[model samples]
Target: MDMIADFDLTAHNTFGLKSTADRAVLIDDAAMLPELAKASAETGRPLKILGGGSNVVLAERLDAIVAIMRIAGRSVNQQTTDATIVTAGAGENWHDFVVWTVDQGIAGLENLAGIPGTVGAAPIQNIGAYGAQLSDFFQSLTAYDLKTGTIETFDAEACRFAYRQSAFKSEPGRYVILTVTLALPRTWKAKRDYAGLDRLPEDATARAVLDHVVALRASKLPDWRVLGNAGSFFHNPVVSAEAARAFEDAPQYPQVDGTVKLSAGWLIEQSGLKGFRLGPAGTYDRHALVLVNHGGATARDIAALATHIRDKVRIRYGVDLVQEPIVL
Candidate 1:
């Protein structure tokens, strides 16, 4: 692996903020991880692991040894009577992998279509869209432990999966994910519990679900290539039942555990920040949750816009809006 100095990260992040990494390297094989760890220790500089750069906000220059995970491979690891286990490298595009699984007749990942990011980052956030989360189909994952300099595997329970959280996220930069294995059901059933999906027929196929999800996401979220956004900028605030009662007319989805998941977009829109713009940074006109860089925007511009929205939402409602992207 060749190390590059002062690597420009403008194109590396979906936000398209212009920034530079002090040092960066790309590793295509897991065998090189030990050496990479050794080099990291020898350099005395902090190390930062990066994937497809979909879920990060590079507000400042990364002053560390940035190791871009590019390890790539995919295959059916096992096929049972009821399920199939498929493994993909960390660098594999998540949406592409989902499409591949559905095309192979595996049905568990259809509802997660059109999500942007790498396979390795999925479990980090326990990425969920529609009515499905990565934790639902996650079998296991292999990661390179920074402290031990050894490769380790973690099962679903070991991952400590929760809403938009996992052990990896709880302890960031501690492990470099190498591969992810998903358990897809052989006997398929469409998951149409989510709002738009509920309109589909009960016998809708995996392809049909995939098509609907793709179309739905396209209509809601701006394409990162065209608008430069990290999809949803904030998580849907889950509040107590009593607190949710105050906003009776607000769109609320009650959780199985009695908590109420209030729509962040609805909150922002209600706060009157929809289509709110300052400089080149602004919330997408179509979706208030999406903060976009409308060309010639600086990292500070986006940060300020986000802060403004958060303050307005917090003032209007008692709930604090938590940003979804990792600002680094």
Candidate 2:
């Protein structure tokens, strides 16, 4: 196990910040994981399981061994009743799979098209947008339990998914997802819950819905690969119906149950932080929620900017917008 030492992790993460990993190895297949487990135990080192590296910010240098999941495959099964059980290897590109599934006429994942990250990390965060979440399509996953060093199956019930939160995140580094099983119907009606999606012209096809979402996201989210961003820096706050009623005159989006969801981006914009800057890190002019690094910036620089926004929102509105990505 000749793991590369002090490897640059800037390119590996979406934020594109300069960072290093003391140990890094690409695990291309599950069959090779047992060997990795043995190697980790031999060295008594904790392993860092990195996937597409979109939803994480490495703030400091780390000495942990990095096991990059590289498993990739797709088995589109018409074997079931008008249902497509598309199982993807953990390392498979997420948006690419979404596009492929849509091409195959699968309907479940159409709303989630264009999200970054690998298949393995999907269920861990229960990634969702545009009236659809990964949990809505997720059936099961095969994970390697680091504690027992054995492969195990986790069903949807066991995932403990909440709004942008999951069991995998709650119990960090316990399960390394290897493959994910998704259930998509060959033909199904789309979910038009959000007013923005509802406002789409009538007779919107699956592709039309996807196109609208992609355009909406593109209009705001800067390309992280080129501009150094991690999509939305904060998760939208969900306040209780009564608490939200206190801000009846204030803007809010209708949410599930009795909850009202306020937009974090709107809050940030209203706080006069749009186009604001701190060192090399700053808020995007078009989208306040997105924090971008203008060419040169450090991890601390971005973190500081995020902290500033959080503080301003808390002070101005008494609402705390939590950071979305994992900050190391």
Best by lDDT: 1
Badly placed stretches (over 4 Å) of model 2 are 192-196, 199-201
List TM-score per model, in order: 0.96, 0.93
Task: Provide the lowest-lDDT 10-residue window in model 2.
Answer: 75-84
Question: What are the per-residue Cα lDDT tens digits for candidate 2 across 1-328?
Answer: 5589888888888888778887889888888777877777888777888898898887558667888878989988554776678899999999988888777777678789889999999987799988789888778899999888889999899998888988999889778899999888766886677656887766677788888888877876888877888888898899988888767666787776878888899889988999999998899888998888886677898889988999999998899889888865
For model 2 the TM-score comes to 0.93
Q: Mind sharing the TM-score for model 1?
A: 0.96
Span of 10 residues, lowest total lDDT, candidate 1: 58-67
Residues 1-328 of candidate 1: C-alpha lDDT, one tens digit per residue: 6889999888888888777888889878888877777777898877787887888988567878888888899999899887899999999999999999888877889999998889989999999989899999889999989988888999999999999989988788889899999888887789998889998899999999999999999888888988899889999999999889998989988999999999999999999989999999999999999999988776788889988999999899877999998876
Cα lDDT of all candidates, in order?
0.89, 0.84
Every candidate's CA RMSD: 1.3, 1.9
